[model samples]
Target chain A: MTLSTMRFTEAHEWLRPDEEDPTVVTVGITSHAAEQLGDVVFVELPEPPATVAKDDEVAVIESVKAASEILAPVDGEVLEVNEALADNPGQASEDPMGEGWFFTMKIADPDALAALMTEAAYKAHIGE
Target chain B: MAADLDAARATPLTGMLAELGGKMVSYADHALPVQFAGVMAEHTHTRTAASLFDVSHMGQVTVRGPGAAEALEALIPANLIGLAEGRQRYGLLTNSAGGIEDDLMAARLGPDHFVLVVNGACRDADFALLKAGLPGLEVSMAEDRALIALQGPKAEAALSALWPEAAEMRFMDVREAVVDGISVLVARAGYTGEDGYEISVSAQDATRLAKLLLAQQDVLPAGLGARDSLRLEAGLPLMGNDMGPDVSPAQAGLGWGIPKIRRTGGARAGGFPGADAILAEFENGAARSRVGLRPVGRAPMRAGIVLFADQEGGTPVGEIQSGGFGPTVGGPIAMGRVDAARAQPGTTLYGEMRGKRLPVEVVPLPFTPAQYKR
Candidate 1:
């Protein structure tokens, strides 16, 4: 896997810098998020052009026992979505970082990225 | 799974895994004691993809003799002789008084070769009854084999990738195939009302095979908690909860398994227990019927809850047998035995739970419509 230094949110969301799409950053749930959610039977992702601010609930991940929301790390509009989860949500457990990416968002405050935890910092935060 | 073997053997450190990280809970007299994820997550994964269950607690037995089919036919209402080779029939075993002893799956591998799968807890008594009922037959125990169910919509496709030979068999069909070079009998059947296969393999090979299936992206490890809710959601009846020695087969809504041809006194006719009373009830409608009920309130109702009529001073007409919050339906659903007059679909009834009489409606059995392959 290519190393792309992404800032991780404490709630398990990750934001990586996008050179080709500089204005928007790729967003996905971390491995911890998938493990905690158990077997993901269904995932409802946010639609493009949908507005979401920092800490706002933007998507839902449903397991057999309960449904949980995936919050936004930075305030912005959803630019694209990973629709592959519509038919195969278990990908969240298999290839969580790649195929399981939930959506991408246009960063509202680029400076907010600096405040997020680095990979090593996240490992320590989750006590991994 | 090795730890489970230790517990099954009654080792002292029974709850060792629970203290570490596994979620412990009590089920069917033994402690489930270990769920790495949560029950809900394991349950959810089984429905969408594949789930591994430890069903070794279930009873496994084999009956072989020249009169094996005849002996089995004397027990279950299904025509066992007509059951072709490598085929299975789902039917009930009744008592002399026309009460259902238990519901079981009988598989005929070859002439004079039959395998019987019974409920986990009821295995001992069921085996005794089978032996006592068929005195002349040669019944042996297949205790060395472990029974595992790989269930879900993706089960067939996933297993087909590994055991290509099992893909051709349809619902209720049985055949043998080699899974990872170990010979196993793969049947296209399951209790969760989903498309899947149940394979009988040697006890030592079970854990290894389960790990192999778990390694596949589509498969996940599930436990009994998910198995119960899934079967409930599918509206399948549990042997003890839905029917017992006190309940008749007609009242349990399993009359279809009793055919008219068998009742006409053909070969091996009238030798089984409960034939007279069960046939009498078959000719005449039962006074009470098992029906499904959905409570109007949020509070969950469980077995032994009394069912009351909808009148101003409604009288108790029935009682709930098994109830729970249906994971798929997002509400409480249950099965109950009620007066035949009040068992009609859409009949309003009240269930007494924790001193409160909750409004319950009498619907058909199986709160959710079944999605069996047949």
Candidate 2:
């Protein structure tokens, strides 16, 4: 799904459900969060096949200024991670919504996705 | 949270910085810009071009007396008495316990006069220490003055356009020059390991001078964030973060500041406060020493991370003193005190962070080579 149709959390994470598989969703940080974090130099993502609770920190993004954690938007089992970030973390800031996707997760509860804010709602929440 | 701007002191260039989209933060009771554009962007720009920095918050003091040089030498380890006119030296104010009080830049303006630029956070204590160390000496604070730094490879070219004499100055040379009819003391020195100049002018004329410099095409306005990263890449230690009262010069790898005149068998030996202990560290090496660390992976190491000898949970050796992402180095670099045995370059170590051990190697300082115009 396109970023315009994705959902976002208050902590600046965005999630987009797979087009064919409704149970799987892709996650990454918002562009606003990337801008605030400055240049991304390193990223540490959780391994696949792991279960994470909502609001659990599953990844670490290091910028030139400081390090910030990427928390889980909703409880889910991790399916795959963005291995490309291991070589070039700048993708998290350059294409945060597209190729910079952190991990794909199998949603534990489909109702949890409905609780996230819509794209337009997230924009207004960040005053953008 | 919103910053308490009302309680913070404003520098002469504060308005100008704010107008340029600088993110202001409260630093050492003064409102200073942490970054103008972005930390990495500003840092990369400074490495290739010239960047102007507002350093007005730093303390500028003048000591002019017949015995000013000799009196000041009693507190610091540098051989200030031998420093010729128009030259500047890096020095440290050491306490009686052989620990560093503050690191500063001392410029010999005249035979009996000298100017000192000290850290902003340690200004009050540094000033008081100078007074307490050298009583009855003419120690005057230049509170009305403002300091600005133009650093990078293009610094000389940009500054020479405004003041022709600035182009003739060499590294560590301090001279008085007239730029746009405003008299300023320009020093050919900087903390960014670049060929640059630090200009000291009156507070009223600071903004105008900064605007004139920024008018150049290659000159950009940088902030403390870039300054910190630049210095880190240059292997220079921060006063409070890397070295403090608990860390001695030898332990901090700053023994170069102690000249031969202050060591044993020299004309003047052990006159400074911590001379006895500091000189001993010179003869017999320090147990722990500051060394550069380059992590194996992309993960950036940060301050307070514990360091180990080999792998995860291997033997706890030391802790990271100052660590951050080095824009010029293209990765994370850090400086920390470790056991002297493991301070050699290429030695393997592990930095513990978030329950994971990141492999780090002991590397030589100045993650990026210095481009000083010597």
Q: Best DockQ goes to which candidate?
A: 2
lDDT of model 2 at position A100:
88
Docking class of 2: high
Clash counts per candidate, in order, are 1, 0
The C-alpha RMSD of each candidate to the native structure, in angstroms, is: 10.6, 1.5
lDDT of 2 at B133: 83
Scored by Cα lDDT, where does model 2 land?
0.90
Fnat of every candidate, listed in order? 0.10, 0.95
lDDT by residue for model 1 (B19-121), tens: 4355444443344433555666655677778776656566778888888888887888888888899889887888887888888888998998888888866
TM-score of 2: 0.97
Give the runs in model 2 whose Cα sits over 4 Å from its true position.
A1-4, B4-6, B312-314
Q: Assess the local accuracy of residue B47 in candidate 1 as a C-alpha lDDT between 0 and 100.
A: 75
lDDT of 2 at B359: 92
Q: Write the per-residue lDDT of candidate 1 for residues A1-128, one digit (tens) a residue.
A: 24356889989988877877655778888888777656565677877878899989888776544457789988888989899987777687667878888998888877878888998899889999
